[model samples]
Target: MSNVVARDIELDFLDHDFEFVGSENVSTIDSTYASQPYWKDVLSRFVKNKGAIIGSICVVLIIFMAIVGVGLNEHTYDSQIIAHQNLAPRVQGLESLGIFDGSEKMTTSSGTVEVNKYVSANGSVTGLEDTYYWFGTDVLGRDIFTRTWMGTRISLYIALVAVLIDMLFGLSYGLISGYFGGAIDNAMQRFAEILNGIPNLVIVTLLIIVLKPGLLTITFSLMITGWIGMSRIARAQVLKLKEQEFILASRTLGARNFFIIFKEILPNIFGQIITNTMFSIPNAIFTEAFLAFIGLGVPAPMASLGSLISEAFKSFTTHPYMIIPPVIVLAILMLSFNMLADGLRDAFDPKMQEM
Candidate 1:
């Protein structure tokens, strides 16, 4: 009901309100565009994780040393030098460092005294001054450094073989069972459950009784039941994915059963499979080491981390250094693989991207 009054608007100030600044320099493409292949994205995420990076470096270094370290010393793993038995770690150039100087304490008649083992054992350090036993010698005078790496090599080999076996057998079994569900699935699952019911220790004991205990026997023992876990995982993944839209599309397109499994389904679940395989490697290594520790590992003259630790256990009080290297190596291997698997799991998980 009031009278309307009109005033002159500031049209000149409207220019500043719509002022364009650096528009020509701006990019037209989307800055947030991050489209990449799945594995590339996974690799990028994995590398961003500091723990995974460190774990990868440790694993690679361990593998490299396992391959190259065995021949670095003149002494073979089985060579026995009675006089050099239980020699402390020594390095030619590191003697002045006070560590790894080949010195040990002895309870002489005069009381305990620390003496340079090289000088005491050889009567003179002249010819032996340059000799280095980086990890010292065992009771049998075998080079521990060589044996430690050799043992790692054997352990890695066994784990890889076992995991490979698991992947092949389990992946196939699970794919077949889960892809075609019904009576076949039930029967196959029942068989798997029956096999899984048997304890691993019992199987190993039976194998030990029937066959010679060595690398092959250990590998066989692992194979007997190791695949069950992988198969179960693969079956779960298959069951969850088989009825999905993409799988249904592939099936509707007349894709063969094997084609659907290995081609369509496998690529989708490959990340989980790889993660599971990495996790399994540490278990296999630990199992082998445990078997070796319990006097059922590889026979004497052949060294594994487990056997090395077992041999070192007797003299651990006197020569504690012998146990340190193998224990540290085993710990690092197990921890590194676990970290790597964890990183892979997170990286491959689609939920992580949203998070």
Candidate 2:
């Protein structure tokens, strides 16, 4: 009788109903989720950084001015008008504010008195007062406004070219040295070390002696030592990445060495490389400026911020305006690049991201 009862219960259990729940919602579930691309994500994070945003804007504006500002005024960067020498800043709209009114404090029999420099220098302010020298005139009577922007253009051009060449050589050297981990790596590293051991100043001075002091010479001097830093960074990154499982898988799949290094590994390390590149730009700019400052910069008629500052230093006591423009522009440019680099670093490295 117990066997019959157990058989009856088993039969009842087999008659239970089955239901498929939420099968229709399968595709709709993932609709609310959005996919973000790597670069897009980086841009999103970079935009969140206010300092980076401001720096980027400032950098863009400065570059734009460097390109276009030279043509804004009638005076060319090298033009000399002795009659207008050392004239104070005079702007059309701002003159009414009493500043940049082409006036300077003159020490005379009546003691120091603010006098219209244009009037004193030209003997009549009539037609001359209408003329505007936004940043004033330099000792050579060249418009400071035009010269400052022209100098900026040269400095930026030299820095960008040098850094780009450095990146190409450094990236190739590092990738090769790091990918092959034995004798080749050792030899390359030793060569890099020897190159690095020489002081940059010495290298630049020697180059100046060999080649004429100009944009090409300064750029070449920077390239000599600049690649070392980039190479080391690239090598370090490649060394850390080459032994990873993906690289091994690629190797196991018979990928060529070039393909493995560039196709597989390069994409992974590119962010770091770009961040380092950004950091390098300001250094190049500062170096060029320093070289120019010490009389090793571009020759006359071709202005650079460094050369501008050097020229302004002589009459800085009496004509303080000359030094202020270039100094301010240089400071802002360097600071902006640094800030942008800092932002790029944080954006690229997830570990460095703020909580």
Candidate 3:
């Protein structure tokens, strides 16, 4: 059997050619691959996702606009022009590009303030004020353009701060709880459950009632129960990671619990934490908006997207523009966050990365 198996095998005449040609003709197969870090692989996959790239660009643009749009505008968000009250959004000529001014002015020292230029049947001018309301004016005649941008800034800030708070508290809480299983884990998890059981909105309402309605108050309220969800997620990840071979190996090596938990386990869960944060930000934004819409948000003179929508609801029939802009902004923000989070999840997935 061995002699027959070793006998020279020959194929009948075929279309294929087998010859000792140049080195280029000889194909060498290699299964070995160069070492590549985890994060590099994640980033390479992340940028390749079209939806995520577009969403990231949009988010960056929104952030930039939130930071710079109001600064470039001549009008202050709070500045009111009674003469231009309830004016509709109008983009005349190059006004949209900021190259041309479209304003109507009225002197406080003078008489009857006017609006858009009008010629009566008698050919006499009725209203004429040189004031530009680019996004038109709110009922108080404040610039919607500046106010919307300002609200964007505030909302983005809240999302960032709230997420940071959640990450700091949640990561630590979960790590400690999961790393040290048994009675300690049970106690910590029960504590988190107790906190989560209390409705966050109810807590927010109670806090707002106790404290004044302001940005700081809103922030504190949102952050109260927000970290619980993240903590649970982190705890789950740590629970899974702690039972792994490497963790046992580290324990055998006499590594400290803190070092093992942070240095060994935490790095493995970093991507998951980031993805969770991205997904959580939109929820935080929506919470702020909801609070603001019900008049439980920032106080007077300060405009949030929710507050703006509430104000717009009063004049919905007459001016729909007020509701449209804020709705669009909120929708875009939420969509971008969700898309980016999904992208990150796919990027960090080993199976998906392989695909």
Q: What local lDDT score does residue 262 receive in model 3, on the 0 to 100 scale?
A: 88
Lowest-sum lDDT 10-residue window in model 1: 120-129
lDDT of each: 0.87, 0.87, 0.81
- lDDT (Cα, tens digit) per residue for candidate 3, span 1-355: 4554567878797556665678988789788989898889889889999999989998999999998989876788789877666675666565558432333333345654533332244667646333555677788878888899888987898888778877788778888998898999999988888888888778877887788888888778766777877888888999888989999999999999999988999899988888888988999899889989988888879888888888999987656666778888889999998999889989988576566
Better of 1 and 3 by TM-score: 1
Error of 3 at 48 (Å): 0.6
Error (Å) of candidate 2 at residue 60 is 0.7
Q: Arrange candidates, best lDDT first.
A: 1, 2, 3
Error of 1 at 203 (Å): 0.7
Candidate 3, which segments miss by more than 4 Å at Cα?
Answer: 1-33, 94-130, 350-355
Instruction: For candidate 1, give the lDDT of residue 143.
Output: 89
TM-score for candidate 2, please give it: 0.87
Give candidate 1's whole-model lDDT.
0.87
